[model samples]
Target chain A: MFQDFKSDPFMFCIVIGVILFVIAQSLFFLIRAVKRAKALGISNEKIKNTISSSAVFSIAPAISIAVTVLVLSVALGYVLPWIRLSVIGAISYEVPAAENAIEAAGLSSGIGADITDPKIFTAVAWVMSLGCILPLILIPLILKKIQKKVTGAVNKNAKWADIMAAAAFIGLICAFLGRGIAGTGELATNDAGEKINVTIGDGAGILSLAAIVSSILFMLALTLLNKKLQWKWLEAFSMPVAMILSMAVVVLISHFAPGLAAIEWRY
Target chain B: MMKKNRSYIDSVHFYGRIWCLLALCVMLLVPTLMSLHLKAWPDLGIVGKAFAATAVLFYPTAVVEVIAYAPLLGAGGTYLSFLTGNIVNLKLPCALNAMENVKVKANSEEGEVISTISIAASAIVTTLIIAVFVLIFAFNPKFTALMQSDTLAPAFKQVTYSIFGAIAATYFVKHWKLAIFPLAMVSLLLVFFGSIPIGILIFVGVIISLLGAQAMYKLKWV
Candidate 1:
């Protein structure tokens, strides 16, 4: 029963249904927003550019998300991960939540660890779903109020508002950068309770750090090229292109310098 | 005319609420239907333990995210983004870039619409891409191997680093005054704490940046 449930056609259909619903919701909003843009006197050309650029910008991240789905599917099965990553599930949140649920159920946690028990599977599913439900619930209940306060504060002073917005974005970006850099040399414990040294100077950590730096450099290069070559079109798709190129760099570096890709210090 | 524009936003909230409520019901149904079909329910005890484990960490961050992201995303974009997820990685960046490209202030009506449109586009594309990828590689062993391969693992692991680095370099160069203090503070906190959740750091960053901006304004530093 457990094995039958893992790759069940019905389960896949349900996941597909959820994805379709999201797509429908997206289309509904897209059409309405485009109409609003038109009513507000935004030109057809600008609107079209926004749509095309956003779609282009999304491809790299979307593929990355697909990688997450593939990662989570090994443990939770394809349907659940597909459903989760598609709707409101961050890879950061899903994996840890799934592991916590598995451990709580008195099961060894990892991919392919006999998670086919119906109760175990159900527990993992519920935990993953319920854990992330707060955002969905809270946003609907309080978003208007939140927006009103935020807009009100910003409206009080135009210059200050501009500064605030820029600051908030900077803060968010800085936090992510800090976290990424900090993780470069952190110690990670595996399921066997062995400590592994993850160093950025000459291991997978280094490759990860190099990807970050390379992406930044790539963006700079794109900026220079856009200026030097007089090609304004490159500006719209530069970030995504840079990101994909950086990932490709990781692949290349790992192939040529395998020792720097990953080195486990078993202790 | 102002009244008409206001009504448009109002109607968006009205419709957004309905859609969000419906999405919630649909999301909840997944677990319910699964349990019924499998004829297996999670033990309440284990469910409680699991929920506590995750909620203790995530709930506060969820609250912070709503507050931090609402102003940037606006109402319509916020609704769709929070519902569809991937706000920080995919949707937020897409919306920001679109708004920047179109030269609209995020506080204005035009900004709101542009944000909504861009987020909607991004959500659609991401959904389509995921659907296509899943269809192609869902059960394929070779594809799975490629995904889990050591050579590719570093690339996948560093995706967030690459993305954030590019974003930071762009924004920091553009807004160095606002960028300097928060970047320093957050980096320090990360060094000290080892692993702070992005939500908490964002909240802290907002407060610090606000203070920093206010100080610079008072000092006539622009």
Candidate 2:
């Protein structure tokens, strides 16, 4: 019954319907943006570069997300995880949300238990859906107001406006950089949701640090080569290209040397 | 002369509102319709408890994310990204890369158009990739195990590092003066506080950077 309920055709139909709607939304915006770009006299080259680069960059990240789909599918089935991950659900939230929903409802002995009962399944789905529903509702409600405040306040000084913009991006990047440098940071949960010590300068920490540095170096090399060799195409796609190469390095290190994103030494 | 149509920004809002609202309904309908089809109604009491558990942690970050990302994403990009998810890891970076490619500044007309275009392109590719994964998993369970294996999980796990490292290379150098203070402070704080949510740290980092920028502006160093 658990397997039958999970693989139900009705669920697949619903997920497909949601996916189609999302794709339609994307297309709606894509076409409008392209038309507007041309209308604004943006060159075809620029538009093409944006699309090609974005699409290419998306592949690695998309696959990473697909992996989350596989993980979540085990418990929730393919369709629920599919809809969740593809539309508004993220790894940091979805796993815990699903687990909590199950435990809270007293539906299973432990999480990842085959949820045979439809009531339990529905309850889990409801929590995951409703919990992350804020952004979807808030954006439409308040985004324009937020934009108006920024525009009215900051745009008066164009230099300041650019500074604020760069500052925002910098802040975001720095937080992620700190985390990358920190790895899972002292502690993280295992599959059983048990807290465990995560050693830095070794284990997961070393790998994360290594990946970041290697990726930055790759980007630097790509940027230099693009400038020196005048590889115009590489200029646009350097980041994604560099990221793919870095992921390869990770696979290689894990496969061969094991751990360490860079060379290590003992004094 | 062709009559200038509704300003692109205005029209974007007009359409963005409609589409986002439609998406909200569709998103809500996922659980709503599923239960109806199965004829299985969950206990409302159990549902409330489950919702509260995740909501308490996620809601604050949701507010931070919408505020943090909306400015950078522009109007159309905001609507599309909120629906499509993975904004930080994929869409935002894609948009930034696109604008960087064309030498456009955020908060400009070119930036708005570029962000929307790249985010849209990214959203399509991501959805298509996930759909393909679903297809493969449905047909072949064995292959899914290989994908979920320990050997390759490192590469997937390290994705965030690689992406941010690549991005940091661009911005850290470009905005060194404005970035240094926040980067140093946040990295230092994170080393000590390890459990601090990245979302909250991002909000704090933004505040620090803004303050740093303000000081630089006052001194005319920027």
TM-score of each: 0.92, 0.93
| Candidate achieving the largest lDDT | 2
Worst 10 residues of 2 chain B by lDDT: B1-10
Docking class of 1: medium
lDDT of 1 by residue, A1-267 (tens): 225686697787788889888989888888988998999999998899889889988887887798878767767777888888889988878877887788899876554455778898888889888998887788778988887777787779888888778777777777676666653343455767554654533222566567878988998888789889987677777777788898889889888988866642210
Weakest 10 consecutive residues of candidate 2 chain A by summed lDDT: A258-267
DockQ of 2: 0.67
DockQ score of the complex predicted as candidate 1 = 0.63
Candidate 1: chain B TM-score equals 0.90
Error in Å for residue A86 of model 1:
0.8
Model 1 stretches astray by more than 4 angstroms: A1-3, A110-112, A184-189, A192-204, A263-267, B1-6
For this target, which candidate reaches the highest TM-score against the unseen true structure? 2
